[model samples]
Target: MQKTGIANLPLHSGKAPYWLFKRMVALSRAIVELMIIELGREELLRRLSDPYWFQCLGCVLGFDWHSSGVTTTVTGALKEALRGVEHEFGLFIAGGKAKKALQAPQEIINYAEYSGFAPQPFIYASRLSAKVDNVAVQDGFNLYHHTIVFTAEGHWCVIQQGMNETLQTARRYHWLSFTLKSFVEEPHEAVCCDVKIPALNFTAKEAADLRKAATILSCENPEKIIKEMKKIRELSLPERHMVSLSDINPENFYKIFLQTYEKQPSNFESLLEIKGVGAKTLRALALTCELLYGTPLSFKDPARFSFAHGGKDRTPYPVDRTLYDRTIEILKKAIEEAKVERSEKLAALRRLVKITQV
Candidate 1:
């Protein structure tokens, strides 16, 4: 799938109406069933990991295509639809908004026992993905919704959304287990946000030196690292700057400092696994790396989909009602027909080929 640019996702409040959501679940269940039958489970996971395809699927399923709520609502509908059918499809979904997000590890563990697969790695990826987006990518967005979809064979996909309170927008990050080689270096298949901001992204390839230096600082006596941070925090930016050193807190590093000192982290990823080693602490460490060791991290927005679909607020082009209705109708019909025996379903589905072509 072609990776598109980041699209706008306005923070839309309120739940999808009961009537519409029911239809969404029905239609999505059928669509996913057909997809798995035709393309296999791994291919389904790959498409879900593609932000553009996932967004389009949400629209085809009848949610507001450009609304941030689509990320949560679509995943919720899929979880409902996929239940009782996981064994046949080889896919399972875990985690969700708020409290549901906390259930992912245990959910994976349970699935592991049932499927006879190791749970630790899956659990680690689930937690690390959240940590990477929440802390490593220092965008202003705070993640409140997380979803993980995986097959019995261990292929997985994660679709998570974070909200920027000040901007009233949401950013969604996508990760594919099969495509990932390293968790720390540009691991995401795509990141979707409404707009760009000046954010510290320590995971960028340009930040290799900063990552190494931060690892070094984390391995040393946290107190010594703390002292180095103290010196950097003391440095002035310019003669007339709006922000001050007091605005930056080096003290937040104490928890990770103590943890790292007690059990030295062998590498940056290991340091990231420590509890309380979050954004502010990592940010301070990066600053310490730069100030003390002359190694700096990048401040680039890592979002890949920039030229994307129109926003709900009509920033680009308004939503095409005709296209939306046709999409829903096409999916609804194809799903309804797909429930039948092979011969009938094939004849009926071939008639809907024009629908999928779009």
Candidate 2:
């Protein structure tokens, strides 16, 4: 069967009329429960080996904007759900190790390198600010950004200030030393990106425009918004300057915007609806929120296909369609054997069948 394009599919967050949203949530809850009760843990693992099932899990685990997260919190939730279910099915049918079977979720998670966290070099907020000071005072005021994997072991920090090579060199070199060590341990993981987050200078008119947009999104509560705005202002000049300038590209811009607006949903929604908002910005905002304030945002990467293709290695793990089909078949038989009366199981099965239509 031909696979569907992700761009053409309705955004899960944007889908469903307000009235139907409640039903959608209810249906989602039912499906999760049904999977746990009937499919069993091992079976879920076996099924998850299928690319189609992996995508289904991704969609289920996903949130409003971020999709790549699938965080430790969510992973824990999935692990907990597997409780009370039999695991022998995964081992017997899938030929995976019994002891290591429990690690399937993490294994599945590891498949996508760029999707989530792997050790990487990061900049400290203080050092970054200092670098910005040097650059801001320099002739060109040029700032460079990169996402680099640390070659060594140390704390990975997010610089709230700016990135300047001189400042980077002057720092305790702790991060750099750590990065180097990481490289020696594993030569393959050492890499980085020269990512740039352009700065924006928010004009008075632009501020007013943002305010109006916020109002339309129902996020204009004066006192509350003022407090949040204060938090946004708490950032250093370079960071604030970045926000004001709207310096980031479409990818990182949304991340920067969310830093100021995540708590202010009205602002977040309005920004997303604006003409210029794009994938990078959305991801940036989500990551900024998650990494900075420890606030939870969406984890799913909105850009990638749910089926996990498009420059992706389609064969991350060997797919086991036979085990998946057998699991489904077992689930069908279990639905029949469910201690509950046949009528109730039938009704639940009906709901399960309807989920496919979605």
Candidate 3:
């Protein structure tokens, strides 16, 4: 699986008003239905996994284009729009903001049972993607929203968001299962953000050596690693390193180190999957590895992209309800006509081509 991108947006509060939300659901359903019909479900999934396309989608659905709420509101609308017709389209969405994000596993299980497809891989992908973002990549943004959209054939896309309250900004992460590879190594296609702060990116390719060394250190007896941690803490390290002595408390991580010592993970990814291994634990290990092996860890922040139609927040203008409704009706009609009339479908495709050329 490949994580495609991360998008940064200003943190905004409050919900989409009821009047707008209802229209959003209708419009989103029509657009998604048309896409699935014309471009196929996989293509829709691919587009959703692209941060740029997703931002445009939120805007087209009449949400604030550059606000944090775009991630949640747009995805929430999609989930609502897809309700009762998942089997027909072969696409299913799981998870959402806050507590709703925690329900992803069970939702995937339910979808899998209905479709007669194995669910464990999708479940693992969901969990590991979240784990990679939240723990392996210490970007100083704690994730608050998580969503996974999957197809009947088992292809999946993960769209998750994290917030840096201190910074008052939100970052959205995108993942697609189109490519299967190592999760902990250079998984992002791009990261879009206005500001790039130093982050502990263990997933960067530069950190391969650090990952290996950390995995090795993890397998050692907890007492030995604890002693090394204490030694590193006492040393006067260079100021350039992001991990400080205060960040790594050996006592706090002693139990986790013991768990890793027993499990003896074969690789960094395996070590990451272990219970209780989180940002602080990984930081402690990374700091120890850097001091011992002279391997450099990456503290590079990964970030990477827009809008159409009037926005709900009235940036360009308030949501034009009449135009929005008319647009929805046209899309629904086109989809219906395309199903029964070849010429109508061809005409729609031609119009799309002309629009794209513009």
**Poorest lDDT segment (10 consecutive residues) of candidate 2:** 184-193
Tens-place lDDT per residue, model 1, 1-358, is: 2355655778888867776677677778777888876688899999998888888887666677678888999999999998787767778889999999999999988877887778887788899999999988888889999999998677899999999878988899999999898888988988887787877887888888888899888888767887887787668643321123565566766776888878888888888989988877777777777778888568877776621333233435544556655666786677556555567878889879968898
* Top-lDDT structure, candidate number: 3
RMSD of model 1 against the true structure: 6.9
Task: Report how far off residue 205 is in candidate 2 (Å).
Answer: 27
TM-scores, each model vs. reference: 0.84, 0.21, 0.91
Error of 1 at 199 (Å): 0.9
- Model 3 C-alpha lDDT per residue in residues 1-358, reported as the tens digit of each score: 2344443477888989999999989998998888987898999988988777888888888888778888899999999999999878888999999999999999999988888988898889889999999999888779999999998787888989888898897777888888647788866544445456788899987888999999999999999889889998788877754466776778888899999999999999899999899888988988888888988889877764322223878988988889988999999999988677767778899999999999
**Candidate number achieving the greatest TM-score relative to the actual structure:** 3
Per-candidate RMSD vs. true structure? 6.9, 21.8, 6.3
Residue pairs whose backbone atoms clash in candidate 1: 4-305, 5-305, 5-306, 6-305, 6-306
Clashing pairs in 3: 1-180, 191-303, 191-304, 192-303, 192-304
Q: How does each model score on lDDT?
A: 0.79, 0.30, 0.84
What is candidate 2's lDDT per residue for 247-353, written digit by digit as tens?
33333333344444444544432343333333334333333332334443321111112223210112233333454345545555555466366578789999999
